[model samples]
Target: MTASMTGFAAHSLNLDHASVNIDLRSVNQRFLELHFRLGDEFRALEPQLRELINQRLARGKVECRIGLTMPPAATLDNGLNPDILERLAHWQADVLQRLPGSAPLSVNDILRWPGAVQTAALSQDALNEAALAGMRAALDELVESRQREGAKLKQHILDRLAAAEAQVAGLAPLLPALAAAQREKLTERLHEALGEAGHERLAQEIVLAAQKADIDEECSRLATHFAEVRRVLNQAGAVGKRLDFLMQELHREANTLGSKSVAVETSRASLELKVLIEQMREQVQNIE
Candidate 1:
């Protein structure tokens, strides 16, 4: 089944130590570009996360935001660096000896010094595993959303195809009548321009005129292209480009039909066909 290039998926996962919330949003793009927003602690997972998204998505500008919500229970003890503390103490003592009456460094001042306390370390492997699981779930949701939207787009295109086919069908039987009327009008005009003396030559001229204004070939090709479009729509995945090309072909045929129109009905049919093709083209742009 085909999918759309726009969707949104958000999922929150509660791991033993941390709760990970992932939000993924995508829109139509010519290529797959990913933007990731993650905390420093989760930076290690960026490459793997990108790889996971690339594997699932074929095209779009996808943005993924990862938020790690750590509860108070997950907070680790702030271990002081005893060696740095000792060095700071020695430096403070040396400064005090030089100034004799300088105030002693307070405990709060020592704790606030750079490198005095170490941040709690997390198990890289465990976090990586949890993040991957959450990411996979979020991606599945994204695909589901895209697929639902794609189904709607497919229906829209199919409806336009039906309308176009009906217009072509309506035009098919009118061609012969249109040509006959055009031939009659041409004969009358020729007879008025040149009297009975030019009857034979006038007949030849009418035939040539009818042949020049023939829309049979254009109408036939339009029907063929319509059939090809329906075939492509039913066949399989990633047919957006193919359908787009077919829409262009349909428009080309419609324009040719209009230019060669010998009757008002033919011109109207051509206009309707162009409208239907444009509608389908608009919807096809969002397909995957």
Candidate 2:
């Protein structure tokens, strides 16, 4: 199924020692680009997280953020280092003896000292595993959101495709008659300018006009491209790039049809085709 390039998902989990939160957001991009916002403790997992995203998504600018909050119990367990506190006290006493009138080191001053208070190191492996699980869940939600939006986009494109096909079908029958009328008009003009001598040249002018006005090839190729687009929409993997290429092809055919238009009706049909193709192109830009 087709997928849109815009989506968001967030998940939070409370473990025994810490609370983990993961948030993922994505927007349209021509290629896969990842932005990570993680704490220093989790920086080592960046590569793993990126690999996980790459496995599931083919295109977009994706941002991932992870946060960990230690629980109250865990926070208390490692709030102070008694060994560092004793060392600081000894250093402070020595400094006071040397300075004679130095004030005693205050609690605030000791607390601010490096290594005086340090949080217990949590298990890196456990944190990594929990984060990976949370990330996977968040990614699943993100993909589902994109898929829902994709369904809507696919429907819109299919409707436009139908409209384009109808325009082509309407123009098909009118082409031969329109070309014949144009050729007849050209012959009358030639006769007016050259009289009887123009009769011999009329046949050559008619053939040339018919060739110039012929849109059968353009229409047929458009139909083929439309079919391919529908097939790509139904595909399971990333088909955004393929659909983009098809849109270009469709536009090229529409342009050719417009240039060759010899009647107001054919020109209107071409204009409508262009409008529909443009709409589809806009939607394809957000597809994956």
Top-TM-score candidate index: 2
> Model 1 segments beyond 4 Å from truth?
76-121, 191-204
**Candidate 2 lDDT, tens digit per residue, 54-79?**
99999999999998876657756768
lDDT of 1 by residue, 1-288 (tens): 778889999998876667778899999887789999986557889999999998899888899988766654544464677888899889988999999899998878876676565434546676677778989999999999999998899899889988988988898788778888988898888888878756689888888988989988887898899889878877756777888899899999999988998778888888998999999999888877
Q: What is the lDDT of residue 52 in candidate 1?
A: 98
Model 2, position 182: C-alpha lDDT score: 82
| Runs with alpha carbons beyond 4 Å of true place in candidate 2 | 72-74, 80-121
Which candidate number would show the highest lDDT if scored against the true structure? 2
Q: Score candidate 2 by TM-score against the native.
A: 0.84
Q: After superposition, how far is residue 131 of candidate 1 from its true place, in Å?
A: 1.8
In candidate 1, residue 236 scores what lDDT? 58
Give the Å shift of residue 244 in candidate 2: 0.7
RMSD list, candidates in order? 6.4, 5.3
